[model samples]
Target: MEVVQVLHMNGGEGDFSYASNSLLQWKVISMTKPIVEEAINNLYCSSFPTSLTVADLGCSSGPNALMAVSELIKAVEIIRQKLKKKPIEYQVLLNDLPGNDFNTIFKSLPNFLKNLRREIGGDVGPCLFTGVPASFYGRLFPKKSVHFVHSSYSLHWLSKVPEGLEENKRNIYMTDNSPTSVVKAYYNQFQQDFSLFLKCRAQELVDGGCMILTLLGRRSQNPASKECSYIWELLGLALNDLVDQGIIEEEKLESFHIPKYMPSPTEIRIEVAKEGSFVIDSIRVSEVDWKVSNNNEVNKAKSVDESLKGSGYNVAKYMRAVAEPILISHFGEEIMDELFIRYREIIADRMAKETTQFFNVTVSLTKPK
Candidate 1:
């Protein structure tokens, strides 16, 4: 499968678009705010550039894209205010897959610029923003052109599905029941993808340039940790249900798999060390526990059924925005409504019994002088 073709958030301002259901991503931006600040601060402390070029890799459309850029510019302004230096010109690049919704991104730029002007008036210099349509697996900028790089919740996606993965007949990603070959295939793919990622950035980033990446990762050394594995497992289960009901073919489930892998902290460290492009500045693992969009209403509900239904409805919508395009590509667009109806029921039922959380691994690295 061509990731460039199938991998993009649902587009348009419609109810099912990623623009409509990205609160979870927004929350992730909020969680990684400090790391963003820290990276910007490091950039400032390392011979602050008179004119800086910053890139946000895999910056998907929606509120979160601008939010990340806003925080970055805020960091720069804060440093300038303290030192009382001349205004610094900035060139900001928003990058995503070629098929990304660049139109929606451009549509919101005027307001973003207007709001930006409100925040840091005359004190800051002129700013230029451009959308770069491409993947980050290779060089996207000139050598030593970028001062800092930031990515969030995007690196977990592999450049391509791992080879030799056909053995995992029942799983979407590495799961408790996944064979050792499946686990090895995923791990090897991650190593290749991440090393290429670092190498590309190493060439693009100036010496001492800092890069901060926040991605879905596992806390436990085990590949099957629920923190990162359960969602796909549950989705696989939903697909299985469709198969049992004869709504979809069994072969579709066998061939269809999510192109995401959640790496462990140890795996990350090992790969970073072997790549030998940058030095690790800081790496942190944080847990984000699942919660219904509105707990107040959930508690107010009189029946357990209502609460579960509500929880599942919101989550299913959220997941659908991000996952719909891929599912539609393989399974056909006709079954999306039905597929997610069952998905929501499964999620709600699971949530009612237990709380789920995802581990976000944030790493700040700097190119050596």
Candidate 2:
């Protein structure tokens, strides 16, 4: 599959769409608010530009699409008020793959603008929102144009699946059982893609501009550790179940692989040092429970089994919303319902035995003047 062409969060606001199932992503965004605020503040105070340009790379469609932009705007407004500075004109760029639901983000703009006006009023400058449909792994903006950049739950995605993975067999991603060559290939691809990403962004960002990025990561030095591999391993098990029942072709499973890699914190720092464009301001590693949810009152009433089952289903829906497009591209859409059903059961069974969480890495960087 063409990663650029095929990759995107599930579009629109449906039960299974990314818009409806992005609580974990939202939590990551919220968790990194202070870092984002500091970056925006630092950038603003550096020059106090009359016009500030901010770019949200991989700004997938959903309530979370404009979330970071909103934070940046609020941050700028607060600083302006504190220093008694003039209004700073805002240029916000929302970027993602061409297949992203730009329409969904656009549809919500009226309310977004209305709320911004009500909250900040005339003190806020013109906030121009533009959607740039392109890949962040390459240049998407002009040189020295963007003042601040933010991306959440992106960057783990490789520009494409690594080459020479035919030996990877039934796995869709790096697994403990993967051959040494497979592991090396994945890391090599990540290093190549991330370096190019830094180079492109370095060109796009003005001197002393700031960028904050949050992505799925592995705490373990081992790329095959459960932190990053278990989720896909379970999904692979679900696919294997289908193959055993003659529902999917074994050869298809062998050929299909996800174009994503969860790097470790050490790996991230190493890349930043190697790239030589940005200084690493801060790097934070945190974990969010795989069973992330907001349904507290309802959960209190359910039995242990009921809660576990509900958690499994919720996690399945979240994964489905994120992975459905890629899976559908390779496996066809007919088996989706059944695939996720099996996936839910497998997750529930696993959760009954142990707690699982996603490792997140949030990094703050700055271009030296």
Candidate 3:
């Protein structure tokens, strides 16, 4: 599948929209707030530009879209207040693939600005927001134009599905049973994509500029480890179930593969060294419970089984919001409801057997002067 054309989160304000199901992403942003704040402060102190340029690559639609940008503006404001510096202008760039729901973000822009102005009062400076619809795998900005960059819950997605996965049939991603060739193919693809990402960002960011990236990752170097690949494995099983029911062709299931890779910290460090553009300031690996976003529903449940069911449904919904578009692109929309229903059941059963969590790797990098 052409990931660039199909790899967008579920859009709109519906029950399954990314806007509604992105609490986990919000948790990621919150977890890395200190890293983002420190990076922005250091960048600002290095050379406080009267007009600053900031870009949030992969700033998918929803409340989380302007979230990091808002925090950044506040960080700059705090520093300015401390130094009694002159108010500054901000050129905020929200970038994502063309397939993303930029309209949702655009519509909410006015209210976002209004709230910011209200909070900052008369000290508020001009904050210009522009939506840049393009892939971040390549150049999206002019040279040395961006001062600060942030991306959350993105970058794990490869530019496209890796080639030579024909042997990876009956599975959508690297699984324990995947052949060594399939695992190697996925890793090779991630290396190439990540290197390109760093090179392009290096060109766009000015010297001393910094970036914070938070994405799905695994603790182990093993690409097929359960921590990173189990979610996709469950998805593959759901697809296979449909195939067994004859609702979807087995050939179609065999051909489909998610264009994503959850790299290990070792892999990330290696890729950064190979790219030779930016130096890693800090990197951390953290785990978030699978029910992180569904805690409220689970808490309200009257029984253990009900809580488990809620957690599973919550997870299934969020996963659907993120993965449904690509699935629909390849398998068609007719199978979505059924697929997720079975998926939720499978997830509930799995959670009953073991605790599940998503591993996240957040790294901060700086362009050396």
Candidate 4:
């Protein structure tokens, strides 16, 4: 199956489900709270409607899934109070690929709604939720429908692996030692994908509407920068270790490609300029620990094999939740637990000497009135 058919966060509320392992994404979104609020403020100043339309694109199923929406809702509630008038009724749309765990989200909907109503107070009007499963690179909403749009940690996923990536043998993503063709392929793919994203949102957003997007990005123009590509490079080493042990086929390693890319600020600016839909308000670049955390709790009663600790372990769980489906599709389901076990070990070892950090890019855009 194509990755589009298989790529999704681990479904259900199991131990490894995204709901169980999304602290990192939550942190990223939290860090962007002020940014999201800024967009909502702009929305209030511009549109100021009693009924509003909002969307969280790439709203994967998990604890972090509601992070963006909840924050936006709170902003909406606060705005209504500040205006000292009747509260607005909201239409909240959560969008992701069809393979996403919408079932889990819908099942948990009752509690989510209850919490919103309780926290936002009785003065607030109704808030309706809908799950929209489709590619954000294309039209997902009617033209000029959404008042404000938000997406966090989601734009990094390319619609598909770049063409000719089979030649990027021994690596699934761009690397320091990668050929020039490999570098160009990844960058070009990101350009096309992000351009289409802006174009679609341009159509969906009304005049003077706003968008706040936070995505993984490179601090350097070179896609081969250590901070940009080292995660997958280390992952490549782990896969080769599995091959060395004769546990997996080497051919399998060469054929697999990750359907993700982290674009640079330069690339993003070029795409936004070329697309010419939304004016670039500002781009705020931030840093996050690649390990997600420096500490993971340990339970004395748990066996060593049953428990893992520290940044590596937490980051491993986060990656596994979001990327496990692709791995299972490529390598089969049986190796998943073992594969993550190996990945965790590698991450832990690397953590001892270096700070594992990644740069994030948050761009604010406004559709012209």
Candidate 5:
């Protein structure tokens, strides 16, 4: 079965726009810095070149990538200072899809570099930064070129939509009560994409290189598990309402899915082990509370109220971003406002039931020495 190539939604930075939010900076620092430091230390201990090259796969626009790069440089400097070696040149590669907002990233780079230079007082050696526009599942650099690779909150996205989903005209995802057939298909697609990702990364990394990845994940293998986020369920309900009102046809909605898969940490370990190129180093699981700001909450509530007040058109933008694109294509933007309003209320209710959000898994791995 051929995979469907749905139009990419959620834009370059992925949902939640972490790149632009200052509150998110600390999250990236705490999660990414130590893993990168470990990778660099291993490389240095192995007598790898002092000039290290690193790649930040799925690096989107804005300050987040730069922030990560800065931390990496500092970690490398500390390692060098401890070893009493002179500073060495570093080459950093930032990669994302071709259509990503490179303009924003380019605009942010110079200022970031200026700040870094001032902080280190020009002691940090030559640091080269460049952007590579290519799919992470394909070859984007020369063999054995990357010393360390890192990705955060990006790998959960499937390389392509599942096969037979578009052909069978079935929703790519289903709720807890969804049929076994639908769930099985989704799992199979995830398995395939994950295997491809491992194969691709294996080809890119040097013999002893390391990859540190953090993504949304589930703790259970049960397809009926409700551990999946309620945000998705609310969005599905909104889309169904639109379909009921004849604002959008069912066919259009079936063409797209959420493009997310939450695999268990054990499942991930098995896949990586099967690929036989990477050894699992560590796994960390934690709950990430992703509450929007008060302003956003207020605005969302306002939008919902307006839609409920017969101005359903006003909430389309919010719903469209959260809803399946196929629904938007068929509905023609008429019922989006109402859909969003209803969706927000449902999500808020769910949140009230559970104040702290639960679930995420981080896995650190290394290629054989």
Candidate 6:
């Protein structure tokens, strides 16, 4: 039998799109910037090189990539100013899937450089900006060429959907009420994708190089019951609801699946250890309060109600509007509205009471000596 490829916004193109929205979350960005800066400082200090080569894996097209790279440049400039030494040349690499929207990123580059020029006031050192489109799971650059690698909100995504999610196969993940096949299937896929990611990243980093990864993670090893607890399940249910309502055909709904996985901190540690190329430097966990829109309670409630009523395509418009092009490409326009309504109900009814809506784990790893 032929294998079916499930495409959802997870690791490849979707990672970048999701990141675009995530970057707008000022609270999250503010908390993450310092950690990233500290990691860069540590790498620079340990390496003791005047020039630095940095790469942002899974960097999507838009201000987010520029924002991250700019922050790194600023951090390095501050260090140089304090030392009274000339700023060193910086090579910044922005990487994403081949299907990523580099046009948007490329268009914004000139503006970013202009802003940099103004900020440095003719004192800025050499900087090279390059766009690389490729999967992070494989070699994108020459071996040992990268000095610092930074990835945020990207690692949780799996390279591909787990094998054996077909109707006949037994699930590999666990469930709250029972050891159902559904949970088992998810667990198996998560393990495979995560392992491959570690192996690939290990080959890319040079000995002593540092990698700082920040992504959504789970605190508990136990399985969750509600579909909203997992992004993929939430999306699946929404699509199912659309099919049931005759908004979309069953064929289209059947083709949808989340391509990523969210793992616990312990699982991450275990996977990294298996690679045998990196040592854990530090692990920091923080709450990530992600809100779809403005935090105004009245407005939020109103939107929620509108979404559930399937009024004015508000539900589908909200999700599809924010969704990456890759997903839109797969699902097309037919299911958009239904998906929105289903998603709204899931969020309002299931996720509203939860305080720990989302959590981020920042793991700093250094290539082994």
Against the reference, the lDDT scores of all candidates come to 0.85, 0.91, 0.92, 0.83, 0.65, 0.63
Stretches of candidate 3 off by over 4 Å are none
Q: Runs in model 5 with CA error above 4 Å?
A: 1-29, 166-172, 292-338, 355-358
User: Taking the tens digit of each residue's C-alpha lDDT, what string does model 6 give over 183-281?
Assistant: 576677777776776677677677778888887666767545332245445555666676677866776555544555566778778888876778888
lDDT (0-100) at residue 29 of candidate 2?
90
lDDT of 3 by residue, 228-307 (tens): 99988998999999999999999999999988899888998999998899999999999999988695767899999999
Q: Looking at candidate 6, what is the lDDT of residue 327?
A: 55
lDDT of 4: 0.83
What does candidate 6 score on TM? 0.81
Over 4 Å off in model 1, which ranges?
292-305
Q: Of the candidates numbered 1 and 2, which has the greater TM-score value?
A: 2
Q: Per the 3 Å backbone cut-off, how many clashing residue pairs does candidate 6 have?
A: 11
Worst 10 residues of 5 by lDDT: 1-10
Give the worst 10-residue stretch by lDDT in candidate 6. 1-10
Better of 5 and 6 by TM-score: 5
Q: How accurate is candidate 2 locally (lDDT)?
A: 0.91
> Could you tell which candidate, 5 or 6, scores higher by lDDT?
5
Candidate 5 global lDDT? 0.65
Local error of candidate 4 at 64, Å? 1.5
Pick by lDDT: which candidate is best? Answer: 3
Worst 10 residues of 2 by lDDT: 293-302
Better of 2 and 3 by lDDT: 3
